[model samples]
Target: MQLTTFTDYGLRMLMYLAAQPEQQCSVREVADHYGISRNHLVKVAHRLSQLGFIDSTKGRGGGIRLSGEPASMRLGDIVLKLEPNMHIVECFDKSTNCCAITAICKAKDFFRQANQAFIDVLNKYTLSDTIVSGKSFLEIFALPQPTNPDRHKQS
Candidate 1:
């Protein structure tokens, strides 16, 4: 049940922004910090901005910042917005699925249940919860941090 790279990067970008809500960030900075492509981050940033997750500014001294509070941003909702499709199996998309056993397949029900369970877990945590939970997540996972500490100092 792996998510696409688009969704993966989208979530990462959101987490980064949520962690430093007091400051604005740029796609180049985030991409360099994460060792990812700036082009990809730009596309993700554009989509996120369009979806009302982040606000963008142009020209000198301009950057992107979160449009809303992190506590109100649900992980499940973000995933659903970033991911173009969530079908785990061919039968999940009835419009294109021509599976012969889709009508009576118990596996389809199991898959549906599994997907729901996955979403349920994500729904339990919001961006604020991830940061405020006080858990040791940094040690377990390697994530990006701003090179310039002052870049995120409260304005």
Candidate 2:
């Protein structure tokens, strides 16, 4: 029941943005802070922007910021958008299912219920609810402060 790296990083990006609601951040900055691949963060950022989770701007002084209030961003909704598919087993996807026992598999129903329960739990939380103190996070990562501290409100 592990999430894909794409979803993991997407959540990280959202959390980071939510922690500093008014400041624009670059993918490179986030990648460095999390010790993750910049290339991957770039893809995640692009997809998040396309999905309307974040606003992206280009050229000088341009960066990315959360598009809406973090309190309104449902974790389950974000995961659904970031995940390619929720199918946990071959039987879950009828189009390409080749499982011999697909017709009578009790495991399929169990997995479906498990997956739904997982999402239902996630739906209980929002991006704001997941934020930790930004100061401690930055200090632990040894990342520099946002140039304009006054620009953003800390969660």
Candidate 3:
């Protein structure tokens, strides 16, 4: 099963915040550092703030920071919340039955098991746990920049 960009960015956003535990990171700063889209990060930050993962403050010297302890924030829980409809296959959705033999499909149960296993693996690591190493983490991921040079420039 593939995660949507929303979930992908959500995780990255959390990782960025997790990296700077002592500072209040602005959406713009995080976007600039990662070369990610600030617009998209805004949405992710807002949702994360609403979900109690991050806190936002307005005014000078104010920005966003992680609310709860990172260890307490489970990756699986964040993914589940960010990704509302995580149906791996059409049959996974109750309304859409694409398979002809879903009723008697033993494979469906196996798929369910596999999905649960996937979640279990995610649960094994929190945002802090994921980025505990440092810049090496960033290097390994090869995360995209917020602005791609190939895009049009008004200048």
Candidate 4:
């Protein structure tokens, strides 16, 4: 299933924060790094902060940082929180479902199973597991190189 831009941006924000555990980053910084809309990232950051996924501070010398350890942040949990709904078919939403075959659609069951499998696979991994190497990510994403590469290294 295709994820909404909101969830996609939320995940990107988390990954960015996970990579720079020692430094707080502004929403604009993340937006610029990913070449996305700053306004959109602002909303994403705000939601993430509200959800306790990131800690945000305002005013001078204030920014955002991961609130919890990356290794302890399960990808499935993150996705579940960020994703508004996991409906894969029209029959999935009971309130709005108007499909003619909803009564006998075995496809809905299969879709549900497939969706659960997707989440189950994601549940097996944590944020830390997704980051093969922060340095490589920085290089690949064209993010600014830290003054001290050693500082960004995972311990």
- What TM-score goes with each of the models? 0.81, 0.87, 0.81, 0.88
Q: Once model 4 is optimally superposed onto the true structure by TM-score, how far is the C-alpha of residue 100 displaced, in angstroms?
A: 1.5
Please tell me which predicted candidate would have the highest TM-score against the true structure.
4
Off by over 4 Å in 4: 143-155
lDDT of 1: 0.83
lDDT of 4 by residue, 7-97 (tens): 9889888988888877898888898788778998999999999899999999988999999999999989999999858898988889899
Full ranking by lDDT: 2, 4, 1, 3
Give lDDT tens digits, candidate 1, residues 17-119: 7777878989897786676779989999999999999999988998998899999998988888888579999999989999999888899999999988988
lDDT per residue for candidate 3 within 1-155, as digits (tens), equals 99987788888888877776677878998777666689988998899888888999988988998887777888999999898788887788988777888888888888889988988999998877988565676564476536568644556
| Predictions in order: lDDT | 0.83, 0.88, 0.82, 0.87
TM-score of 3: 0.81
Question: Considering TM-score, where higher is better, how would the candidates rank from best to worst?
Answer: 4, 2, 1, 3
lDDT of 1 at 2: 89
Model 2 lDDT per residue over 2-63, tens place: 89978999999999988888999888999888867799899999999999999999988888
> lDDT, candidate 3, residue 80?
90
